[model samples]
Target: MPDEPKRIVEAFSQELHAAYHKAGVRSYEAFAARSTKINRAMHSDTGKHTFVSRSAAYKTLTGKRERLPTWDQVAQFVRVFRAEAADRGIAPDSVGTMEQWKAKYEAASARFWAAKKAAASRIPAMAAAVPAAFSDGPQTWWRAYADVVPAWSERYLNHEPLSHRITSYEPVYVPGLLQTPEYAAAVIRLGHGDEPEERIARRVELRMLRQRHLERVGERPCMWAIINEGALRDGPVGGETMRAQIRHLRSLGRHVQVQVIPAGHPAHDATDGPITLLRFPSSQFQDLVFLEHADSALYPSSEEDLAHYLHAVQKLGLAALMPDPSRTLLRRLEAEI
Candidate 1:
């Protein structure tokens, strides 16, 4: 029988493939040559040389084989890629050290097996794409997914340097980038009521910092946000707070193209859920979809998952009020508030 697809392995494989591409190691011959050089520098293993054939390297990237690549094989790829990145003066923390690469490899391996186990116990298709981590599901599953990912804030917001495009659908509230300080504070306070005031303040500060990406000097991220009308209407965060937030959204119209999904839009794609799709300029780094939950965020790796969310965004865009009309709606909402 053929092996089932594992999103964890596929995701890691893409990252590894991207590392090689960024290093300008295109052909299998060149990759193997670099591997040999790195192996010689690290050790004097005359008998056991680092050798990965063209077919094997291709299989690793394509995720065609049943077994995951060995750690030593992954290490060789990482070292060569890191050295190339250094030559170009690029220092990404994701692949900065051997230990980091190893940790990621191990985590991905563990997740693959876990998915397989879940498939065996439940249904075979459960292992198809690792089930969405933050989809509407049990809290235990969500927590388990969150525990596996770290520095999520960094992963979500630090795409500033990548020159990517961001399209977000916000059904409940205004996006962080267009939120006013007072509005942000009120929302945070309500959500994290038990947290200390100082901690909440720090959290708010970090969120504001992430918003800086929108104001970058050259080639800032192209942002398109579609907000639901309910978010504007159902607000008890004090009239002044909501009013200011609406005005802030209007001001952000200068940079971000904001749209309003008027209340009772018959074609509301967000009725199911919301998603943020990120597209990169480089072909090496695949498009990403970010699903934000109450306490955790999800990065879906499957192409099917990505397509579903991207299609939702397109439908929302079609149903949304025009940009000029969206600003007009915001102004009208502000006056009512």
Candidate 2:
């Protein structure tokens, strides 16, 4: 059994249920029977106990059980579910195989646990330092910290959609949502310089795919971005590429608002690095702030944390040139290049 953070466990369970439904397994009993068959076949000794009861399946999915299911059990679920999905003529290609799903599970668990540990220490420090009044009452914040945003971040963007407004401050590079393909490719290569070309290409593809939310139908969000002047001047991605990127940002118009801070602007509040705040319109989803570091990423939702970032953004805005002027600056930069 994998002892993972509650969020990863919940996501793992949700994946099982989703695959189960897609596989046309309507009841826990049926799913359990199918898994048992696979398990039994694999452990053909006949003396081994391979059967899992329907109650156990239910408990696993709902997280009611005290302990998690064994690794073998999860493998059985994945195997049976994939077979069933294939039988129903649903392409199982994207769903992935048992080993791939297991890899994803392990990755998700690692990310969750890493963030959990960081939050455990950071939250207390934040609480002690910030005013009590700034503490948002009993809020749960999902945090992640890493040099590059993980692949799993796309899931959050898709699941939450554009109804969740994204506000980001980039001190080094362009925000993913506003990046050009060439610019993104250059950035990804710089970060994953040692990785294979295929890996680098996939990273660029995913980054572009994440921008679809802007064009997605129904309740589009107003994405606002604050870019440092350094990100503009710090270009080595080629003059044509930089020109296209600046023009692309200028072209986003109302869909995305871009503000540029001049090179010498002295707003050190956001100098720590990139900061992102995901604000969802739905009451069920609380606003989240994403902070990334060299080694890890944090998703802190405490009132105090959110307030600090919000103020930082406000400071950034104060120091930034407004949209029109920013575009003018971009045009100037593009022309100079």
Q: Which candidate wins on TM-score?
A: 2
Off by over 4 Å in 2: 1-162, 268-270
Candidate 1 ranges with C-alpha deviation above 4 Å:
1-154, 160-163, 268-270
Q: Per-residue lDDT for 206-229 in model 1, tens only? A: 567667777888767888999887
TM-score of 2: 0.55
Residues 143-180 of candidate 2 have per-residue lDDT tens digits of 22222345434224433343458888987678988898
TM-score of 1: 0.55
lDDT of 2 at 143: 25
